[model samples]
Target: MKKTVRLILPVLAALTLAQAAQATTPSRVVQGTTELEGEVAKLGETFTLGKQSPLNFTLLKVEYSVGHVVIGNTVYSPKAAEKLLLLHFAVHNPQRRDVRYYWPDLKFTAVDAQDRNHPYAQAVARDGTTERLEINLKPAQKVNVLTVIRVPAGGGVPKLLVQREAALLRYDLRGQVQPLPKAVADPTDTSGATPLTQVPAALKTFNPLERFDVRLDDVKFTGEALNGKAPAAGQRYLSAVFTLRNMEPGGGRYAWSDFKPMLRDADGERVEYNGLLLKASRDETAGGTLGAGEEVRVRFFFALPANVNGQTLTLADGTGRAYVYDVSGVR
Candidate 1:
């Protein structure tokens, strides 16, 4: 009788252990809200809110801190018995038109181990500012977003809950907690004044406007002063002359707005346009109609950081066709 009882006890012990292990294992599939009846996703996975929405979300990483969290120059602390949870993710807009969104549009919640819910506390912007969370996304634009939530301390892995109108999504952040990364320096800083590569001068032409063929006549880097007036500190000016000819057999209207000119530095960062200088200068182009075979010379001005060297000029037509010109050698 004793031997029989021992065999049964061993079998019961093995069954209990198996059940405990299964309970702790993370499940990839989870239930969604009523709107998203069939959607399921795991952490580090990308998912869309719904078929009608053009927004896509991907949870990249998650971090938790029991101590104070530092963002920019401000430090945030959680209430007693709670910890600060940081969620790093990317929000992407794939549509052609611009999409504007505010934080309240997507309801966010953090579910702790005890099944208690916590709301989002704050959001950090690209500049590390914890102000209002609002963004305008251009076509094919993706922006990284950081959200902070306060969850009960000593809770196991928490799950992120997001709801957008009719769709709801959840991500189980289990075994994915990582140490907060050190703050990274801004990549767009050009204060080092690195010299740009010089490209040989050449004649470049672009048909950026309807029924118009434009030829680049010359590009000149006019230092600081325009019409005897200098720009504010840390700014310079550039001027480019283009010869535009009407290509249509009939007369056609032409305007500077027809061709949107953009200047970029060696790192592909945009150089701001100086409207004040253009308004004051006599070389600014004017809108007019041109007859067939008529050609006119137009000059455009751009403002750039004093430490930056302009590298390329991008011209876009009304139809969104773009043409690039090398201007690194203009001095």
Candidate 2:
């Protein structure tokens, strides 16, 4: 009986210690706000804005540093004695239809400890895409926004000031700012000239527009003039052929220009299309109304440095999505 009792006592004590350790372990942090309207809200709190078409906004987190900040593939640094502040937040539109809004539209300003006001420098998406001053949000859509601001390094806790037509909204950012972390190396970094994936030659259709389909057919590079149109000195012409089709029940307008095509090399160098060359080609399918089930072949021309190789053609819809086509064979 004594031996059994001793064994049971050790087991019970071990179980209790394990349970205590588990209870003391920290869990994930939940972000929320505890401030009311007309009062300065703190970080992790949700604030309501707008009157008729209301928007629920929450400041999730903030990062500040005097060093460089990386947005997408670009790096931004502040001047001496200045630090960059990044405010990350979410905005929701609860309307039934699409609503257009922007950070600047809110008339946001940052008030420093010295009572100096600083306007927003810029805003970008997580992928580093620059956010225009106006963006359309579908009903019930939520988007994460990042805004960059420059403030004095010694500036005491800054407050966010929002100007509305009826009342002003303020957010206290004390104890919410954290030091910016070192940027991790991106696997897709092209500093070493890593090549993009080669798109298969098989027909791969991309629907960049509503009720429209597009597919790359061929790509060619030439140093000579094309149909009496010659490229400038030390430059060559790259022509990409594509097939466009309309799938809408009713006729719809289709234009190659709508794709907003651009060429990016493996080294991140970009080149723009030659508008004159496109107009000079006079491809009947360049811009026209396509009936249902009708398709047309279109060609676009771009002038690039004679030495550029391993390039990719990027075509974007106005809605922020882009399609990439490998043009490494163009060399």
Candidate 3:
């Protein structure tokens, strides 16, 4: 048995490495005018901005801002010799299932007039103007992405090398810095309830939440204690499934801890998620950097006294911006 296991291990390792190699092969976008066969796109390249790629994605538009840039309700001011850039894009997922779109995971570099390379700023701009680290999307979801990168103060961003997966897309950034008009409010705001139309345009900057943008689409509660397991003595388990969308375009980092969750009773008494319940539903509480244009369905579980009623769930982003959902229907 030992000999057989040793023999199979090497073969399994070889197969895994082969699969990884094949998965990293570069794909081309059908819309780019000039496709460089390699990963680096030098200056003078004319890559199409909005064409859908063979990878099932696209880069819609690119914008830049200097000095103090205001996105939503936050302002981003660069340091002494640095400038901020806003790369706007639309990443579409044509698949039938949810896919992970990581914007910051993509590499961005700036090339100055003197042929120098400056890496993307390590720290992303604060607020919704930035991107999430990882974005999980539902089927056929098209997310509008806004990404901000910092470059040197003086040298112009004549060329930008964008590396996505194994492919390299080079865009000529010369003369592309357009002035931003006044930020406008979405007409739908007056409707009262947040829109979950799944349309990209519906994703607007939600105020009060400083670093991240999120709106609760819908909530579902299971009256039963547990779906696949039994409940504890005198305690009943209730689960709330929430559809959350990360609104940052530059794709940075967010976590489950960021959206502090709490439960309040009819009398205004507050309680948190049961640690044991969270342990059982580990996948439901998983947290990390949510990519721009990504949406995640998170399930939060609480164990309450069987007779307790009239409860509400309050979820807050890192900025203390919160939304309350009434759980009274489950009673």
Worst 10 residues of 2 by lDDT: 191-200
- lDDT by residue for model 1 (1-331), tens: 9999999999999999999999999989987766345355576677777556558877777776533443433445543344567777778887778888666656678887777788885455442444444778888888877777876545444577877777778777666665322211112322211111121224564442335666777777776456456766787777777778765555677775567677888678987544322322364436678876698777777877777778988654444234467888776
Candidate 2 regions with alpha-carbon error over 4 angstroms: 1-37, 67-76, 122-134, 180-331
Candidate 3: global Cα-lDDT?
A: 0.53
Reference-based TM-score of each model: 0.40, 0.40, 0.35
- lDDT by residue (149-263, candidate 3, tens digit) is 7665454567877775566776676655543222321234432112221122112233223344444443433445453556567766566555555555556565556566677
Instruction: State the lDDT at 32 in candidate 1.
Output: 75
Superior by TM-score: candidate 1 or candidate 3: 1
State model 2's lDDT. Answer: 0.62
- Model 3 bad stretches (over 4 Å): 1-36, 39-55, 67-76, 121-133, 179-331
Clashes of each: 0, 2, 12
- State the TM-score for model 3: 0.35
